[model samples]
Structure formats: structure tokens, C-alpha cells
Target: MPLRSVIKTQNNQRRSFGRDRSGATAVEFAMVAAPLFMLIFAIVETFVISAAGILLDTAVDDVAREVFTGQIQQADIKEAVFREKICGKVDFLLTCDKLKLDLRTIPAFADIPTDVPMKLKRVDDSSFCFDPGAANAITVLRAYYEWPWTASFLHKLAADTDGNSVMFSIAAFMNEPFGDRLNSNANCS
Candidate 1:
């Protein structure tokens, strides 16, 4: 073979090898970036939702404690109080207006059917009010939160049209705030 032809053949092979690797990195990056970005976003969203739920649960527990202790008057157990005291703490993630608070008294802990109903009870007093022979009374406080899912994919896969509504409840039995003089109608005086 001629020296010039041999040199040309070598150069052509080198050019073809370089061209083959040039676009490979870009294709690999395109393949990997999309799913990686999606996974990161999903992780962040999960943390946000979990933090919101924890904050709400803590707020409900605190409010229910105040109610049972007679620190908050029965009349104050309205929507306004929930908005100001509970929802106010987690306004960044949840809307106070969308939350529902229900308070009830249960005859026994066993009688409380679900977290939705049990957490709504403001005053349990079952331990203090019940006869020694009778089943202990319990207070249940139910807090229903209508959480709105921000991610479109999460909404489509995990949430309903009304958004992801989660109901959280906290219950405890303690002495009645007013002892024997406790009147169901009267505010804590």
C-alpha cells in the first residue's frame, strides 16, 4: 500500500472513533436526568406533606389539652378558634378555613370507633366523672384536615378530586375541669 493511502486510512478510523463518543454522553445524560429529577422532587414533596401532617397533629393535641384543662372556654371551640390557634401554626402548608374540628365525650375508650370521631372530643373526664364500677369516660377530639396536594402527579395518583383529605384525632381521659359542679351548658367559670 502507498504511504499516503495508509496514513489517510488511519486518520479516517480515528475520526470515526471520536465521532461515535461525542453524542454518547449527551444521550446518557438525557436518559438519566429526567427520572433523577422526578425522584428528587417526589422526595421533597413527601417531606413537606409529612411535616405538615405532624404540625397539624401537634396543634390539635395542644388545643385539645387546653380545652380539657378548661383554659379555653367551650364557646371558643368554634371555627374561629381553630383558625387562629391550630391552623395558624401551619398556614404555609394548610388552610385553616378548610379544617373541621369536632368535640365529643365518649363513655369509654373502647366506645370510640375511629380517629376521626375520637379526636373531636374536647373534654374526656371519663376517669373523674364515671362511677368506680362503671366504664371510664373518655374525651375525644377529632380534627379533619382537607389537605390539598400541590404536585399534579401526586394528585392524579394518590389524591381524590377534593384533594388529599386526612383526618387526625387525639384522645385522653382526665379529671373534669370543674369537678362535680361541671355543668354541660356553662362555660368554665
Candidate 2:
């Protein structure tokens, strides 16, 4: 109970506490957990986005055939019908309402526009131009969707920052000689 003995005991207790390894597991976990969880979430998000991209590409490939073969034009398939077909072919997770499509047919392949549009820059759907030109013309089809996300970082990484990532698919091909598309008043507009 001397002052010197009390000081020595306090120093020894402090040193012991500093060297103690009892909480090492929690400390190590804390150091590793943040990065580990981030990596896991990133991987999951990457997988999902990749899957969506594949699905979109597959749907475009399937639907583009109808356009190339003039089936869509011959049937006079309305714009809504074409959209409905595309939606039916896509995954259930994709909201059909969010799908935006742009289909353009040019006189020749050389005349094809070189822009890769992903989202609707303008809000007016009526303002869009759709020209599924005559038979043997080159047609380009583009579709866009905003996939919702719960992960903040992934959303910020996306071109759109509202916790939504823009997913798009494109297809270009020459219309087969099924019939003269110019003669048919395809209601693609």
C-alpha cells in the first residue's frame, strides 16, 4: 500500500492490457470485414449486370431476326406489338415499362448512323424517329433499360447515378428479300 508499490502495479497492469491478445479475433475481423464485404457485394453486382447484358443481347438477336426477314414489316406489326414481343422475350426482372427501343433502317449499310445511344436523352417518345426502310435496307435496333440497384457504389459507378444502371443492346442487319418493304405500309411508326 506504499505509493511506489501502487505506481508499479498500475504500470504493470497497463503493460499487460496493451500486450493482451484476447480481442485479436475481433480486431482482425474488423480490419478485414469492410473490404471483404465490399468485394463480395461487387462480385454479386458484377455477376448480375453481366447476366443482364447477356439477356439483353440474346433478346436483341432473337427479335432482330423478325426485322431482317421482313416478317415484322409484312405483318404490319405495330410498334406496340414489336415492343411486346421484345418484352416477352426478356427476363421477368426487367421492367417492360423501362424498355426504350430505337429502330432505324437506312438505304444502305454505308449510310448507317454510327451513334451508340444507351438511354433516352429526351423524355418525349413521340419525338423519336422510326424508319424501317425498304427491303434490302440495313436496319439497326437499339434497346435500353434502367436496372434498379440496392448497392450505392455500383449505382455511382454506373453512367446513371440514381441507383440505376443503364443496360443496352444493339443489332444491325440487312433485310432479307422476303418482299418489297416500300410497298407495305408497315405501322412501325
Top-lDDT structure, candidate number: 2
Supply candidate 2's per-residue lDDT for 73.
Answer: 78
**Stretches of model 2 off by over 4 angstroms after superposition:** 1-21, 117-127, 159-163, 181-189
Each model's number of backbone clashes? 11, 0
List runs of model 1 lying over 4 Å from the truth: 1-21, 74-79, 115-137, 159-167, 175-177, 180-189
Each prediction's TM-score versus the true structure: 0.64, 0.74
Lowest lDDT 10-residue stretch of candidate 2: 118-127
Candidate 2 structure quality by residue, lDDT tens digits, 36-71: 998899899788878887888889898899888877
At residue 39, give the lDDT of candidate 2.
84
